[model samples]
Target: MTTRNVRFVGGPLDGRVQDLRDHEAVAGRLLKHIHLHDGPKIETQYELHYTPENGWVYFLCGTQP
Candidate 1:
């Protein structure tokens, strides 16, 4: 499997680097990322979108309890 190095922008996942598989590297694709807060003990959902220029851009889908 081939993967591309992608950077996440915005929200809690800003500046985070991750690997994007070729199959999942489509434009407008929704990627689910769960961020566990250490202090407040909260979960944040970032529905990242894949773009050709920006890589993955964060989309605030709301928080989970």
Candidate 2:
């Protein structure tokens, strides 16, 4: 399994807490879509965080070993 991290900058979640919530919602949708196609056997390990200083949204996605 491979792991990847995705980062978004200056798109929507720019120093906004509500934007972070929106980002999470979008992430959930993506997870659902992947599960639908790949079945329920895949495991996801990730973290979502927002930083006003950096002005970027980050997603850390990884698979279990």
Strongest candidate by TM-score: 1
Model 2 local distance difference test score: 0.37
Q: Roughly what TM-score does model 2 have, to 2 decimal places? A: 0.30
Cα lDDT of model 1 by residue, 1-65, tens digit: 98877676555766788787778766566556665556655555656576667665556566666
- Estimate every model's Cα lDDT from 0 to 1: 0.65, 0.37
lDDT string, candidate 2, 1-65, tens digits: 33333353232222333233433433333321123245555444434543555433444355542
Off by over 4 Å in 2: 1-40, 53-58
Error of 1 at 13 (Å): 0.8
* Candidate that would win on lDDT: 1
Cα deviation of 17 in candidate 1 (Å)?
Answer: 1.1
**Candidate 1, residue 50: how far the Cα is off, in Å:** 5.7
